[model samples]
Structure formats: structure tokens, C-alpha cells
Target: MKMLRIISYAGLVAVAIMLLVAMCAILEDSVISHRAHRQELTGSTLSSPGLDHFS
Candidate 1:
């Protein structure tokens, strides 16, 4: 029983770490895109808009 309890706790910790990693990745992507947008505004880069209002 003690071993099973320890295993369960370890599993939960692994899941929590995975979730944190995923969240960090998403945040990093957003930050990178925001920086790119700034460059675009300054004419250092160009990218097409992803969507239009008419659709």
C-alpha cells in the first residue's frame, strides 16, 4: 500500500510538470509572435493577416 501511494504521488507530480511545460511553451510562442508584430509595425518584417471580417 505504501509503494502504491508513492507511485500515485509520483504520477501526479509528472503530470503537473508536463502541464507547466506546456503552459510555458504556449506563453513563449505568444511572446515571440508579439515581438514579430512589433517588428512588422516598424516595417522590419511583413506578414499577412490570418483572417478577414467578411468571412
Candidate 2:
């Protein structure tokens, strides 16, 4: 019983960490896209900024 409880706790912790990492990655992607949009509007970086530029 004791070992099972420890394993369950570890599993939960691992899942939580994975979720946190995924969330951060998504947020980073959005931030990068937003910045690219801003640069496009300002016309400072590329004249023809397309979808490929963001990715």
C-alpha cells in the first residue's frame, strides 16, 4: 500500500510538470507570433512577412 501511494504521487507530479511545460510552449509560440505581427505592421523587418516568418 505504501509503495503504491508513492507511485501514484509520483505519477501525478510528472503529469503536472508535463502540462506546465506544454502550456509554456504554447504561450511562447503565441508571443512570437504576436511580435511578428507587430513588426509586419511597423514595416521594420521584412517587406513581405508571411506565415513562414512566424513559424
Candidate 3:
């Protein structure tokens, strides 16, 4: 019974760590995508004369 309890606790910890890692990966991807989008917008704005009228 004691061994079972220990194993269960270990499994839970492993699952928690995996979930945290997955969340970090998702967040990293989101940040990268956001930066890429911003860069593309910046590039477009720089190349377009009409956007200057809006500013």
C-alpha cells in the first residue's frame, strides 16, 4: 500500500511537469508568432505611402 501511494504521487508530479512544459512551449510559439506578425506589419507600413497619411 505504501509503495502504491509513492508511485501515485510520482506519477502526478510527472504529469504536472509535463503540463507545465507543454504550456511553456505553447506560450513560446505564441510570442514568436506575434513578433513575426509585428515585423511583417512594420515592413508593410514602411513600404506603403498611404499608411503615412494615417499617421
Candidate 4:
């Protein structure tokens, strides 16, 4: 019974660590995607000549 308890605790710890790592990976991906989208939008606006006249 003691060994079973130790194993269960270890498993829970491992799962928690895995969840933390997964969350970090998702956050990094979203940040990178947002930056890319912003760059594209900026590039498009800069390339247009009439944008300054409208603003």
C-alpha cells in the first residue's frame, strides 16, 4: 500500500509537469503567430500609397 501511494504521487507530479510544459508551448506558438500577423498588416499598410492621405 505504501508503494502504491508513492507511485500515485509520482504519477500526479509527472502529469503536472507535462501540463505546464504544454501550456508554455501553446503560449509561445500564439505569441509567434500574433507577431507574424502584425508584421503582415504593417507591411501591407506601408506598401499602400493612399494610406497616408486617408489617415
Stretches of model 3 off by over 4 angstroms after superposition: 44-55
Give the runs in model 2 whose Cα sits over 4 Å from its true position.
Answer: 46-55
What is the per-residue lDDT of model 4 for residues 1-55, given as tens digits with 9 covering 90 to 100?
9999999999999999999999999988987776567658787534345433322
Which candidate would rank higher by lDDT, 2 or 3? 2
In candidate 3, list every pair of residues with a backbone clash. Answer: none
Could you estimate the TM-score for every candidate? 0.75, 0.78, 0.78, 0.76
Clash-forming residue pairs, model 2: none
Instruction: Select the stronger candidate by TM-score from 1 and 3.
Output: 3
- How many pairs of residues collide in model 2? 0
lDDT ranking, high to low: 2, 1, 3, 4
The parts of candidate 4 lying over 4 Å away from their true place are: 44-55
Write model 1 residue lDDT over 1-55, tens digit each, in one string.
9999999999999999999999999988987878677767778655446632211
| Candidate 1 lDDT | 0.77
Under the 3 Å rule for N, CA and C atoms, how many clashes does model 4 have?
0
Candidate 2 per-residue lDDT, tens place, 1-55, comes to 9999999999999999999999999999998888777887888885454644545
Clashing pairs in 1: none
Consecutive 10-residue window with the lowest summed lDDT within model 2 = 46-55
lDDT of 2: 0.83
